[model samples]
Target chain A: MATPYHLKIVTPERTVFDGPVTYIIVRSTEGEIGILAHHMQIITPLVPHIITVYPEAGNVEQFTIGGGFLEVGNDTTVVLADSAERASEIDVARAQLARQRALETIAQAKPDIDLIRAKRALQRAENRLKLAGHSAGGMTSA
Target chain B: MAAGGLKEVDRRIKSVKNTQQITRAMKMVAAAKLRKAELRAKKARDYFEQIQAVTRRAVSKGGAQKLVAPRTVQRKGFVIITSARGLAGPYNANVLRQAVAKMQEVGGKNAAAFAIGRKGRDYLAHRNIPILQEFLGVGDDPTLHQAQAIAREILQQYLGGEVDEVWLTYTKFINPLTHEVRTLRVLPVEEPPAEESGAERSYVFEPDPETVFNDLLPRYVEVVIFSALLESKASEHGARMTAMDSASKNADELIRQMILMRNRLRQAAITREIAELVSGAEALE
Candidate 1:
């Protein structure tokens, strides 16, 4: 078994998670990247996506995160997300409502409403919806 | 001297009581906000502390040397963060005072400002200081996007040579009862001294260290500004809560004094009426 690495997920509001994890799969700007023990030290930016964490003994954990930076160095990986929420903590109904609102906002494209911001909001809400829905149905679709 | 009428004293007491209720409510609201703000400020510091680690490593590796090269500062930009409303007591004044003093030292005409709160914008405008940008309605909870927008403007100005240097001023939240105004030199990003010389570890750059540093520097600036905004928000709430608490207490004291005076005046009026009644009875006899 591979040794566990320290993984910390921090947001502006609080530290969402911090513990030793055997592996982590995060969606980066480049693409979805997985890190294990002894992964190369590199820094990358992340997109709004789901982060899957495999702890040593407990069941796998998942989180929905917004854009931010990730640094892997010295066997420690730190994820400073703009915002983050655990999969269990996400509200499906609220996420759906937000996604619908974002779509409406982008469709309107009013000068006051930024199209990029609305699109990002939709992406974040969709990420949360997916993460929240995945556990309900036992399908482990990547 | 004629003692005040009972009706007037009653009216004054009623008005004071009404004001006291308002202040008490305000204190409660501010206390609730302060709790949330303090929590957020502490969390924001965690992000800042993590970035500091990244920045320190990058700086030690000479990643930010190009960005931090000193240049002659002919013009300076001040990013002043205060509160949108005035009920925060001296919170806005303390931050604005330091910013204005710095601006005056650098010459008002040569100084430009990016005001984060309505109070800062209005204060700087009245002082004849040119405001490059004004962000209003950010309220007690400022978002990362708001911080990014403000940082982008300051970065653009600094990079465009419009401003040779930038300074960020805000109230730093020390505790619920104490806060201090602080100013940080933001532009021409200074390379922080590495904590340990031999503790550096080799970091593999996926896309070259310089490119990562380039992307990281702007984000670092955003994080700094965001954290400062969070601290200022906490401080503002703290100040408002303290101010409102004192105001409510003062009102309580005023009401007590007024009630005592009103009772004394009422006693004197009753005494005079009793004496007049006795004299009338005697006259009839």
Candidate 2:
């Protein structure tokens, strides 16, 4: 069995998870990376992506995080996200509604509407939907 | 006449009792809100510390020098955070007073403000200070999105050369009963002190140091603003809680005094009536 390391996922709102984990896989801005116990120290900005954590053998948990930073120190690995939600905690109906609203707003493209914000909203909604096992409505073309 | 005086005291006691009820209710609400705000502030502080540490480490490694380098102060921008409503004792007044004092120190015409609450906006406006923007109704709980928007505006002004220096003024929460107003510079990010830079490990910055450093600068500012918002929120709630608690106590004291006076008046009236009756009976005999 791989050695366990202390891992914590923190957001501005609260700490999402704090425990010992054997492994964690996250998509940093550089690319997909995985960390094990006693890894070299590194700091990287993360995009909005799913973070996969393995607390023990055959046990896997996933969380969707809004863009933030990841720091691997000697004793602890911390993920600082603006927002994060465990797969089980995501509200599927709310994600769907948010996605629908974002799409409608983009379609209308009003002068006063902030397109970048709408797109980011759509992206977050899709990420949540994907984590919740929804198909994301196949709207990737937008 | 004694009866009339007694009735007047009763009416006053009732009014004071009514006022006490309202103050008690307000205290309870403020207490509940303060609890939530305190919890959020505690959590956000962890994130803030971590981010600050990392940013300091990066800066010590000679990253994002341009952003960190200080410039000549021409125009100054103040982001003053207060509350929307009053009744929070001196919560708003204390912060505004300090902010205005700092602005005067920075020179009146060279300073402008970005007001984060209605109270701040009104105070600045009443003083005839130029306000660049006003954000109202942030409510008791501030969200990260609001912080991001405020950060964006501050950065735009700084980078666009509209302002040379940017500062944040808000109340810091020490505890429910204790808080103090603080003003700190936010722009041209301050470098970490040289003494603490020792024994720092060199970490690999992803996608090259420049890109990561550039990205982290704005984010660092955003987190600072966010943490400030949380601190100010907790302080505001704490101030309101203490203020309301004292108000309720005052009402309690007033009611007690009035009740005591009414009882004394009642006894005096009874004593007088009995004495009159006894003297009349004696005279008839």
Q: How do the residues B1-285 of candidate 2 rate in per-residue lDDT, one tens digit apiece?
A: 999999999999888888888888988998899999999988888788777877887777755565676778789999999999999998999999899999998746789999999999998999899998888888888988888898998888888888888899987789999888999888777767887556556677787777777778788888888889889999988998889889989988888888899999999999999999999999999
True contacts kept of each: 0.58, 0.61
C-alpha local distance difference test of each model:
0.82, 0.86
Candidate 2 TM-score, true structure as reference:
0.87
Tell me the lDDT of candidate 1: 0.82
Off by over 4 Å in 2: A1-5, A37-41, A56-58, A102-120, A137-139, B104-109, B270-285
Q: Estimate each model's TM-score.
A: 0.82, 0.87
Q: What is the C-alpha RMSD of each candidate to the true structure, in Å?
A: 4.6, 3.2
